[model samples]
Target: MHPLSLRSARLRLVAVAAAVLATLAAGLTGAAGAQAAQGCEVDYHVQHQWPGGFTANVTVHNLGDPIDGWDVEWDWPEAQRVAHGWNAAFTATGDRVNAEHLSYNKAIATGGSVSFGFNGTWAGVNRDPFAFRLNGRTCDGTVGEPTTTPTTPPPTGGESAMDQVAAMQPGWNVGNTLDALGGETAWGNPLITEELLAHVKSQGFNSIRLPVTWEEYMGPGPGYAVDPARMDRVEQVVDWALEQDLQVLLNVHHDSWMWLNELGTDHDAVLAKYEALWTQIADRFKDHPAELAFESVNEPQFTGAEGAAGDALTEELNLVFHEIVRGSGGGNDDRLLVLPTLVTNADQPRLDALKATIDGLDDPMVAATIHFYGFWPFSVNIAGFTSYDAEVEADLVGTFQRVHDTFVDAGVPVIMGEWAVLNYDHNRPGVHQSGELLKFFEAVGFHARDKGVTTMLWDAGQFLNRATLHWRDQHMYEYFASGVTTRSGTASFDSVYLPSTGAITAKSLTLHRNGLEFQGLWHGGTRLAEGADYTVSGDTLTFTAAALTRLAGNRAYGVNATVEARFSAGVPWRVKVVTADAPVLSSATGPSASFAIPTQFKGDTLATMEAKYADGTNAGTATWTSYQEFWSNFRPDYAAGTLVLTPEFLAAVTDGQPVTLTFHFYSGATASYTITESGGTVTGTA
Candidate 1:
């Protein structure tokens, strides 16, 4: 008989659960008894007719009193077999159907419930609401009705926080931790809040790629004590995500490896310390459903500082991962584990070394991760130097796609652990630069959604309007937080699995209500709409739904009668052009539009100005000796003068630099001048 059978029948009863299902165990068969049986949860209710060929709908409830999780188990004779399952995640074999972990068992409120199900056929007969066993223990009583709706359905098992991360594709690097997440030390930063957490959630960002300082979390001794406060802070943030119904991944971050980059050192002692750290974390959050995951190390590039030949280090780290995962007190045996590259860079040489598995931990949850920071110049392209040129910008995006395709094709999950704007502080010359940045990001966001690659943005700190912190500028980084924050009623986003083919245009996108709101006029370059013609029905803006017509000159062009829509007030506001049913990051990716600026500012020309509440031709102009100086004072100052460029007869300041000091001359005695910059600023995250 099976080892689990004796525990269920006359041998002894510990915890009871629904019928059993055997899960796959292709790797690691032996381990200490304490860590022998895998962990799981049970159901309080079951829905089905008496056994044979009947489908069993089990509600996997974390009913361990004031509970976070429960492990439900039951033994099945070889004569019976499980056919299918749903709601809660499940895995079964010829003699067992085990479900000890509940996917939907979120903060199972005092007496709240989450249900799951499975269909199986007993060779002879079976009973409904069968007695269940949990973790080799038996439940005190039988399961309730599978159809009884205490509230919601059970969580699908095997699901982890990394699942949602499979959205942000093609990652980048964080350079130094201080420059990351707008934090100080690479160690800690401002506390996590609902809004900051939501910001990351909306940007289609999936992972945190946290670079933890291990020496910081480790205490003296083999205990490898991960600080409770720090851990709590990390877990608290994860908790916020779980609240948003998102995923949270935790890793050994960048600490230990940054200083002690080596992999071999009395592997036993090291593994034990790793074990201790996980034991504490796992025990506390083990039942956080499966949304929480563990990553081995950040950028464990062995061989001193940073070198490619040190990849053999990842192999040893893999050993540590397997040993700790299967060791005593580590409930992470079946949990998802993210493995990084030699240097964690997605660039070619480093990516080539990722062909090997963790030797033993090649389970489905074992995913591959790397970073990507394409075309640095684009982010720091101050003087419009290498900027502009849409094709070049799009080319960089292609590079991102190439790297993503390479890893995804490998079958294992690929995560762009770190990615962001080249310069978090872009202070210059770049057209289509903003659009280029967003265009590629959006394209990749769409592609990542299309494929199943999980992604994580750098972190969230310099990006939110927390409001509590004091500021010298008064406005705070709120400008960065504006459109990026995930507000209520915004566009619902997720990786769109639905597939469609053809030339299509997303039209008349609007944002109104508590959802996405607009603050600028449409910038012409982006061409988010079909053309300059369009109609609006409330907030769901629609564009020229007409079919595209191909033209000559090696260009595929289509004529869209309607092009843009302004999000003024009243109704639903749109944030993006997405395919239906696709999961969208709750981001405020506003339409390509601009808000009016004062005449003192440059960029905006009279042709683009719209009278807020006026009639006739209202204009503002300025006259200065030098174009450069003119631009300096190019703001609105309610002055009655002629818009002149003080032609200077090429006589004064004769510098070949061609400094034309032109000034905007306001016509109608200070017509409340408005400046409409040619380029609309790009800021916002989900």
Candidate 2:
């Protein structure tokens, strides 16, 4: 989604009413003094209620610096007793309630939050609790007044708005094809048809986030009329989605014309176009059912050199969009409008900025939306391989956590407007590749559900084959349909590529206790004929002497294979193996360092250099262009760019000390140079 900057571990996971009730904790509600510090903020949402029962979601945010742990206490103005809670230990004494962070959630980094919810019984009235205290400190800021839960039933509107949003099924974005740079077919995907919508629905996605750009379809100046034909096309798509019983979110996407620094250059003109655009859109959809929503903008950015000034301007523009839409009359008054952050970034700062900018806005139906493509190395299916590592889990949780703390905890609903991991060859031999993918989705989905944040999967015909009207990856489809709780023990091998000849044995294959041992080997999606193509012994698969030759004899992308095993249940295991070859720098080279390229960059052309000092200071950088220059000046010295110690950088190098130089290759392969400086010369090894 081209979020301006993802920053770092900038998110936290939140639990929504759907899953909140499932994780209720049983404990004593702690007590705190009125003098408790004022940094903690709480948002108590009564998600659903019955004759004598109700469910509530509470988020406790640490607004100050990082804290090792946190405790939140509150007194119910109404008679309410906690039944159970999740993510924290909870207790209720009379009308007072208290909660403490769980082991994993104890250390809340500054501006981060943890959430918990519970089911309770209220005899007289079911009102929200206020005057919350964190770690013996009173929460000072006024977040928002509680809104009554909607009266709609199970499938729609019978619960709180948050609950209804939480109930939204997995979503899919009809990406690049519809949100194509030029037009629907510009991106090589066929025009949108009802069949595609039905197929998507059949796959279990109940919501669709249509990314559309209106600038190209609009006329010039004042009344920036979105062309009638384009409007019809959009309406047609929306109608198709609605017909499929899918909730649709439509936005003024990539409208750089009016959204790009309009607040700084021609404020009134930009505002006029924005309002004019929304005026038409709001009026057009005013009669549409509540299933359709309007997003003000997509990835709004102000790069006119004004910096934060542009952010302020964009914020003002968002306010205008909200006002115009709400004032458009009809159902517009109750329509849900999503406000994108300055750059639609999910980083803590951007989220905080968004929260601050939209503060005090009277629209309770509005949600703050942001796109997440964080930790591309793992989250993205680059090179058809990615890690579901601890780092990825940590980053995902931290990033979502901040979003929950900043907006969701403040009474503003948050939406992960776009998120997805490409569908690749997830059927690797030993590791549960499909299972891992499901876990990733489930992790994000569960947190999103718990936080009342809806996630829309971004699909630009990457995972789904639009022309064929089928999913390119059925495992991914199954995972989405089955939800995260479904158990599977699918495993992927350490490597799927076999050499021209010889045995390709999987090393240290992670085995589940009582799990079914390796039963068969499949190559190119076909089970290799037993004893002819390969032989299996214990955990090893020995390709017969000529198996590799026969498999890849004429294949273009080479042959792929996976070893299969079955397990009664799912279990977590860690099996470490040295996979990628580290780049080597020849010590013989002086001033210029030569490198042994990793396998990932075997035939790739470009390379980029990123340098930094010991203290994390920028040293210098060179883009892909420098790769050619390096080779032209010094031919065939290993591969790609050879870092030549120029006087500028040499001067900064301390004698006999090491400076880290990172090289980024075009193939997503990365290596580092541990260079040591000696008098008048530089030499290093990677």
Candidate 3:
């Protein structure tokens, strides 16, 4: 099936970092107490306040000796209470509050700082704490007196870009919506509504990245005016998101590759059109609140310009965008502008170029943005990367670290504009296995938090079922949500496969403690008896043969039981007990352009397929690797009881040559077959 077709079918079926301890203190109290040889400095800024609720960011700067662990203490001037917090452990007694460091951010070097944030509620008055004590000692130095007021006005677009983006943690993208090829609903999603935005907020997203394609809605060159109705619709969505208190990230999406990419060949015309587009956008939302941010382009690329030329073109466009937005009056003057690297890639050179552009702009209201779809091979389940192994994780960490050191550490914020496994578009039974997908997300959340980069999940319709208005995989969402604040224990795999026709044997999984202590295992609500039902050896959890037999009731096919591996904190990992057997393949004949192998799965599920020539060289599409791309060159139609090879694969093979095909199933069962293409016909033998 076509990748996009599978995406459509799935839709239809369901449907910041440390700023050197200075700039973060803007508009808030600085260090208190006298400047002693050994003291601390605390910068507390109320990020957002509304009615009885407000969010504040606190930075504790150590001005004394280096410490291994530290805690910041403050007293609320009113009856305000912290409802939730991140980056630290918060505890309150009456009016006093203490925020302790977490396992990751527990150390503070002399003259260094650590930051955390929390959401609080108040009664008649909400006043800033007049004093802050670090490790039982009062902070030294002061910027201004604590304000005594019940209400602080909303952000006035004057907040620094870094601070603004910091408040926009855990963002969600409304993908394939306005950016849909034909129209808003052309991509199979329902019309954008306030309820949808509200639902996103309810899911813990503090921001929404609204991707828009304005080409079809724009007039001919010169004026290149955006359709008023289209502008109205975009404004409507932005306003709805803002109403839901979600920071809206509006951007020119697909248009980047549509017409914007022509900048290299049609420089003048493209520039004129680009300037006109931004001019219209800026004028329309000029008066919007600071919560509304604008991004220049989405994964921008220029045709006919591959190297420095392409970089120059992207830089020029960003400069033009910045000028137009800043020149426009109202909130646009100080609004946060998010600029991206070439194709929004995190490569070192790309990040360096973008950094130079931001630094050259000399504007503190500008932030860097990039897109991550993970390493190519693992992303699409191509080659032999069928799991989220070491290579996959290294790629993720390296990319985030590059962006962090380049932008975040330098006091500029970074926003990961679009991130998600590319295979996610194919939905369940997709190219990626379930356990690997979970690990990918878990790592993404943890690393992004560790690097202080705001991430926006790219969801077309697979994640949240627009029709049902609920997460299709609630457990996966839990993993993501938990990663925002703390780490969660995960296992090497999510399932244990047992032969349905043979004696069940003990199965073991390596538990990834992730710094959390593992609790006992539970089947439903009952905890399994240790040593009898299961045993833990270091990080490995082993289930006894007797336990497996009992769990796989009647040796049934598919999942027989489900259990949860509980940890000290974060979401619990779920393990599935499945029963399967060796698969059988039969010979088949068809045209040289198409072929199929009749198969009895016997409760087994296909994982990856490998094709090779007699000489042992790779065969079929992606000949660089023995394992062909899933769902591309080959796929198993479980319902049809046949493993069909796509015409693409058949066409790539040499006629009169026999090729060896190996099918790998999730149940550890493998089946081999031989296929020969002669003239216009193909024959297969098991």
Largest lDDT belongs to which candidate?
3
Instruction: Kindly report which residue stretches of model 2 are placed more than 4 angstroms away from their true locations once superposed.
Output: 1-159, 257-259, 305-307, 377-386, 421-443, 449-451, 483-506, 509-561, 564-686
User: Which window of ten consecutive residues has the lowest lDDT sum in model 2?
Assistant: 1-10
For each candidate, the alpha-carbon lDDT, in order, equals 0.41, 0.58, 0.81
Clashing pairs in 3: 15-467, 16-452, 16-453, 31-141
Question: How does each model score on TM-score?
Answer: 0.45, 0.54, 0.79
Error of 1 at 623 (Å): 38
Cα lDDT tens digits for candidate 3, 236-273:
99988876667899999999999999998988999999
Over 4 Å off, model 3: 1-158, 426-428, 591-594, 678-681
Candidate 1 residue 546 C-alpha distance from true site, Å: 26
Per-residue CA lDDT of model 1 for 321-392, tens digit only, reads 655654534346566677787767666666666655543445666777766554543443322222234554
Let me know the TM-score candidate 3 reaches against the reference structure: 0.79
Model 2 per-residue lDDT at 484: 26
Backbone clashes in candidate 3 total 4
**lDDT ranking from best to worst?**
3, 2, 1
Better of 2 and 3 by TM-score: 3
